[model samples]
Target: MSNELYTVIPDGSVTTPRGFRAGGLHCGLKKTGRNDLGAVVSDVPAAAAGVYTTNVFQAAPLHVTRESIGKEGKLQVMIVNSGNANACTGEQGMEDARSMRDAAARAFGVAPHLVGVTSTGVIGELLPMDKVLSGIERLPAAVSGTREGSEEFCQAILTTDLVKKEACVSLTVDGIEVHIAGAAKGSGMIHPNMATMLGFITTDAAIDAEALQSLLREATEVSFNMITVDGDTSTNDMVVAMANGLAGNEPLHPGHADWPRFAQAFVYICRELAKSIARDGEGATKLIEVQVEGAVSDEAARVIAKTVIGSSLVKSAAFGADANWGRIIAAIGRAGQPVNPDTVDIRIGEIVTLQQSRPVPFDEEQATEYLKGDTVEIHIHLHQGDGRATAWGCDLTYEYVRINAAYRT
Candidate 1:
């Protein structure tokens, strides 16, 4: 009923929420027999919302998914596959995306318009519908509203992701217990102005479709949109969420009394998942958090934070524990935001390396020691206003280059 509503279940996943079931299986999409096809279905019609990549050239599956969501605000299923992006394959690709949804709907006992489909991995490849449909036919039996079911689906959706990613939290609305959960995948091509990231969230809190869309956009601004793996955003970026009203809670809207608590928990899960994706950036060794504060406005702070975290120089320096403060300051200067040259300050962890735009006489050994840790925090203050923002990335290394160079080979 209040902001202090729910607790986090350590072993929770997308299926932790009520009314949801998920499963995945191998269908020869990947070179090996790893599960590459997956689906998540709700027991009832659920309100749905999606945010997608802003790239000029869109993917076929994205178009199909959009049509499904546009037909009705409610959805019951999402079919996803890894190893074949099905992007830019022309008209056949669009039909294949739609066909996958229809096949999945029939297999799951739902309407085709109530199903959405997404694909990831190699672009410009046509989806092998025969194998994908075969996988869908068997999904109903494998899918269940259990942790194992969610875990299997998680693996099926991954491409370069090193490990499964999921987050869940519990909350109460109108005295009714509600659960929210999410899962995502991205290891490279992840500069989320949306990312190559594909995120799916399921919840049992009855929320209005319009309200859900607004909430997702606002939360993404500070979560998914604040993460960077590399400078490139992928062709298949998307995050969709479904809310089934099985929790018996009062409907949530912008004006709902418990909307704040629900939104807080929702954003927390998104941020955790975002951080996880950043930490797992291809061949990354350490997580990097860039915090920008005291800017002229929140938007300015966000730009500065993102620019700093997305800097290759800064990332490489962190990888080597170089303690190169000049790279950090140079990044700030080139962020294209108005900053008082004499009012800037910077720090790595707790070690102050720059003060008021001047080099702070500091111990190189201390700075190197701080950067040697598994997580690095870069803090900057402009001393101009109260605005603040945080962005996440990872330490760039030689392994990153090696992995990406041979990514397709």
Candidate 2:
């Protein structure tokens, strides 16, 4: 997606931006020896923005992060942990979250409100503060502006995820070069309206908190909010972004001449991260994409696309390499959106399985072969209007049930 206005950094991460450093270390949270605690810090206060899970039972760390960022619209450091969600533990959970923030602030020599904290993992468990504070005390010593540090940070924030999700891009902002990078961790308990994921973005662009917040929300609607692995939403989903104004570009706003370019690059990074999460879904062997076109509105198209991608029948059919157009059309019909049944068309790859709302007699062998690939695309045309949308998910397999059935054990 790189072009004249922007370029992609092949090897980029959260620490790729100016004035930032990150690292991670083991904290006895996970059963394995992998690092379970991490922190990303900036040399100076940076403008901050965040979008959180809409679940009524929000996690404790989310409240702590929101309070810190809402205080002054800035943050100097973000502390995170995995393997313990610290949710449904009542007041004790909130105290532990704030304690995590205070410990990071004390270690980094920053004010408490300038530190943000978040956590993920098994719900209804109390965080072991002894291990967490010890990890925080040693966190700063591990911090550095290097790829190794970024990789450690990424590794520390995983549970069921098999691969690290990261993206970076650069765009020119008024003759100044600005870089944006992000890292995310998510595998299951994923669906629209956010998922069981934690995303962090860093940039060197000079932007205010208000403008950055608006841009983050808009980008999320088309990226993170359009993907699902399972139909369950989690309590700890959050995406936060920070800009340190180190790029030396003029302050950016919605009216800036190059704002659109920067936004494009930002949205691209976010979409890449979101797609990676979908591709790496728990026990998933293939990624499934649903593209809807010619709807009454973009929102309607999005609804139809999500419905198709989230259908268990559709996912199972893809997993079995079956060209089941019936499941696809069934999902579209139940999406509760406007659609002209007589003018509908559906295709699996280049093979048209249905046209004008009727069977088209496609090659079963060819269609099955296409579905067996690592990625599959389902194209649907409503022929009702100019609206369009794309959604991503993954094929369901027996392995998925096996993994989740004994996850807590």
RMSD values for the candidates in order, in angstroms, are 1.5, 0.8
171-268 in candidate 1: lDDT tens per residue?
88998889999999998998857888899999999999999988999989999999998889888888999999999888999799999889999998
Count of clashing pairs, candidate 2 = 0
lDDT of 1: 0.90
Winner by lDDT: 2
- Superposition error at 19 for model 1 (Å): 0.9
Question: Model 2, stretches more than 4 Å misplaced?
Answer: none
Best by TM-score: 2
What TM-score number comes out for model 1?
0.98
* TM-score, every prediction: 0.98, 0.99
Instruction: Report the lDDT of model 1 for residue 395.
Output: 85
Each model's lDDT comes to 0.90, 0.94
- Model 2 gets an lDDT of 0.94
